[model samples]
Target chain A: SQKIEQNSEALNIQEGKTATLTCNYTNYSPAYLQWYRQDPGRGPVFLLLIRENEKEKRKERLKVTFDTTLKQSLFHITASQPADSATYLCAIHNTGRRALTFGSGTRLQVQP
Target chain B: GAGVSQSPSNKVTEKGKDVELRCDPISGHTALYWYRQSLGQGLEFLIYFQGNSAPDKSGLPSDRFSAERTGGSVSTLTIQRTQQEDSAVYLCASSLAGQDRTSWYEQFFGPGTRLTVL
Candidate 1:
């Protein structure tokens, strides 16, 4: 069975600091990995995506690193703010499929 | 231009009743997807549509659930004889295209319809 796991425990970090979230998968090799931000009562918003061959991708204050060797992806939010407090999800695209299989997600709380 | 849009932001229906949820993908987007999100759970893939190709229904939980995308634009997911377990938020997303050669298909999601099967 294929599975993707993220840190279930909520992560708390001070504003202006970097917040890091982890996503690990097993039993599959995805063509690409994506990160999304979801707020309460709203659908997810795309953040960044990195291909299997790519080591890193960046967009504004967000950066994502994909390590196929480690079977993990790390999402980073630099200079975090209270507004950045939300659940972040990691999703993977399976072979021959464009749909994403998402992990349970990690909740990050950026305190001012 | 408007992004993806779903109808009936919230719906509360009795168990065993049939429910239909609608989705309008972003204009010009050729790929659409449906997903279910239970409380405190990850998004569950439900279905996918790309252009005029046959839909990928592999993620549908059961035969009671079915979906159709008309004219490669608007889509509707129908649940017959819904059960209590059907209570969840149904999300719709659209991308330009599905092939890897196209731009990375970054999905733009709708606000979602919250279906409460009571």
Candidate 2:
């Protein structure tokens, strides 16, 4: 069976520090990977996407790296602030199917 | 532009009862999807619809779960004989089109309907 895993432990970081989240998968190869930010009591909001051929993708203060060979993806938030705190989810599209399989997600807390 | 929208922000129902959740996709979006997020869990794919084509219902958990899209726009997800395990926040998202790689069809999500089956 295919599996996707993210850090189950909550990460606490000081404001202005970089926060990195990890996502690992097994038994499947995805054409593209995506990251999303989800707040409590709300749906996830799409953040960034990186293709298998691309090593890294960036948007403003967010950056994502995809290493298909390692079956892992890293999402980084640079100069993080309190408002940047949220649960981050990593997802991959299932081939031939329009659905996406998401990892458990990592919760980041930026304390001022 | 308006984003995806869902109705009944919250719903509480008894076990064995039926419930219907609605989703209105963004105008012009050709692809719509339904997902369920259990408490503290990741999103679970439920179904997918594209234009006027037959929808892909492989992700539905059981025969009790069914969904339909009308005129390629609005969608309804119906759960018959709802069970306590069905309690979750149902999310809806839409993208411009499916199978288009050139333009990453970013999915826009709705606030979701939080269903509590007791």
Candidate 3:
């Protein structure tokens, strides 16, 4: 069965440091991969979308890279702040099935 | 000044009772989706509504669950004879269809309705 997996269940880092989260999938080749930030008890908010054709994408303080060959995506938050603490999820959009399949997500905690 | 919205932010029901959850998508959004999040688990796709077409109900867990979108704006998900296992946060999301290819239904989600079948 196709499955998406985030590297860790929880990560803790200093506020000024960088946080990198990894997402790997198996038995599936997705056309596009998206990242979302979800706080406890709230809906997920869209963060970034990287296509299979694009190697990398950036928005403000965040960066995402997609490697179709490796079947993985890496999400990075630079100069992370306490506000960046949340569960980050990576979603895949299979070619014919556009509805996203989300990973379990990695929880990040940035301490000041 | 608007995003996707869902009603009854929290629901508490007894076993064998029926419950209805409603969702109001952003104006003009052609696509709507329902997802269930169990404790510490990833979001599970439940159902999807795209315009007037028949919904993709493949993700629905069982025959006891059904959903409908009326006039392309509002949607309702009904769970019959709710069980304790039915407890979870029910999330609703909407997005514009036929938008940029890269976005590929970049959904805007609503603050989910937390259903507790006690």
Candidate 4:
């Protein structure tokens, strides 16, 4: 069976520090890898997307790196603030499927 | 400029009863999807609809779960004989390109309808 794993433990960081999250998957080759931000009681919002051929992607303060050889992706938030604190999820487009498969997500807490 | 919207922000039902959740996708969106998120769990794919083509029901967990998208816009996920395990946040998402795998369209999710089956 295919699996997408993320650190379930909440990451606590001081304000202005960089927050890094990891997503690992096995048994599937995804064409596109995406990151999303989800808040308590709210649905996830789209973030960054990196294609298999691409090694990295960036948007504003967010950056994502996709290493298909390692079957892992990293999400980084630079100059993080308290408002940036939320659960981050990683999704992948299964080769032939139109829907995305998402990881459980990692929660980040930024303290001021 | 409206995003995806789902009705009945919250629903509570008794076991063995049936419930229907609605999703209204963004105007001009040809793709729609249903997903379930359990407590402390990731989103589970439920169903997918693109254009006027036959929907892909491969993700539905059980026969008790069924969904329909009419006119390629609105969708309804119906759960019959609901069990306690059915309690979760049901999320609906939409994208512009349904069959364009090359495009890799990002999904826009709705606020979600939390279902509590007792």
Candidate 5:
């Protein structure tokens, strides 16, 4: 069976420090991967999407690296703030299906 | 400019009873999906609908779970003889691409319907 996993432990960091999250998968080749932010009671919001063809992607303060050979993706938030705190989920599009399989997610807390 | 929407923000039902959860996709989004999230867990894909074609019900956990999308717009997920294990937050998502198109877009999710089975 296909599986996706993220670090189960909650991460706490001081404000202005970098926060990194990891996602690993096995038993499937994903055409693309997506990252999302979820709050306590709300649905997940899309963050970034990296295709298999791309090794890395970035936004203003966010960066994602994909190593298909390793079946792992690293998500980094630079200059993190209190508002950037949330649970981050990693989703991969199954090569044979349209549905996405998501990891359990890692929670990050930025303290001021 | 509206996003996906699901009705009954929260639902509490007795075991063995039936419940219907509704979802209204965005105006022009032709792809709709249903997912469930348990306590402190990742979202589980339940079903997907594209246009008016046959839905992909592969992800439904059991026969007690069924869903329908009518007129390519509204969708209803029906659970019969619900069990306590069925309690979770049901999420609905939509994207702009129709089934005919090969290119896909990011899915916009709704607030979700929190179902509590007692």
Candidate 6:
């Protein structure tokens, strides 16, 4: 069965540092992968979408790297702040599936 | 400028009772989806409505769960005889469909309805 896994433990980092989150999957080849930021009691907001062919994508302070060979993706928040503290989710859009399959998500906590 | 909206931000119901959750997708969004998220769990796909097509009900967990989209805009998900396991946050999302491949995969989600079955 296809599965998506993220770090279940919350990650705590000091402000002004970089935070890296990992997403590993097995048993599926997705056409594209997306990242979303979800705060407590709110819906997820789209952050970035990286296709299998693309190795890396960046938007301002956020960067995502997709390595289909390793069946993994890395999400990075550079110069993190307390505001960046939230649960970041990884979602994959499998071929022929209209809905995305999401990972359990990794929670990041940035302390000032 | 409005995003996807779901009614009843929070619902508490007794076990074995029925509850209805409503979702209003953004204007012109042809694809709508419903998902459930239990505590500390990933989002579970429930149902999908795309234009006039017959909805994909494959993700529904049981026969007691049913959903309908009226006039390709508003949607309702009904869970009959709810059990304690039915407690979760129900999320709704919508996206553009057809022609634009990029836009099709980017979904805009609404603040979920937190349902508690006691």
Of 1 and 2, the candidate ahead on lDDT is 1
lDDT of 1 by residue, B1-118 (tens): 8988999899999999999999999988988999999999889999998874645889999999999888989999999999999999999998985466535458899999999998
lDDT of 4 at A57: 90
lDDT of 6: 0.94
Docking quality band of candidate 4, CAPRI definitions: high
Candidate 1, A10-109: lDDT as tens digits? 9999999999999999997889899999999999998888889999999999999999999999999999999999999999997788888999999999
Best by lDDT: 6
TM-score of each: 0.97, 0.96, 0.97, 0.96, 0.96, 0.98
- lDDT score, candidate 6, position A94: 86
The 0-to-1 C-alpha lDDT of every candidate, in the order given, reads 0.92, 0.89, 0.91, 0.92, 0.91, 0.94
Candidate 4's C-alpha lDDT? Answer: 0.92
Instruction: Give each model's clash number.
Output: 0, 0, 0, 0, 0, 0
Residues A1-112, candidate 2, lDDT per residue (tens digit)? 8999999999999999999999999987787889999999888899998888999999999999999889999999999999998999999975565678899899999999
> Residue B21 deviation, candidate 4, in Å?
0.3
* Fraction of native contacts (fnat) of each candidate: 0.79, 0.76, 0.74, 0.82, 0.79, 0.79
Each model's interface RMSD (Å)?
0.6, 1.1, 0.7, 0.5, 0.9, 0.6
Per-residue lDDT of A12-51 in model 5, one digit per residue for the tens?
A: 9999999999999999798889999999989899999998
* Pairs of residues clashing in candidate 1: none
DockQ of each: 0.88, 0.79, 0.84, 0.89, 0.82, 0.87
Off by over 4 Å in 4: B98-104
Q: What CA RMSD would you report for each candidate?
A: 1.4, 1.4, 1.1, 1.5, 1.7, 0.9
Q: Model 5 misses residue B57 by how many Å?
A: 1.3
Error of 6 at B64 (Å): 0.6
Task: Mark the regions of model 3 whose C-alpha exceeds 4 Å error after superposition.
Answer: none
Model 2 spans > 4 angstroms off: B98-105
Distance (Å) between predicted and true CA of A89, model 2? 0.6
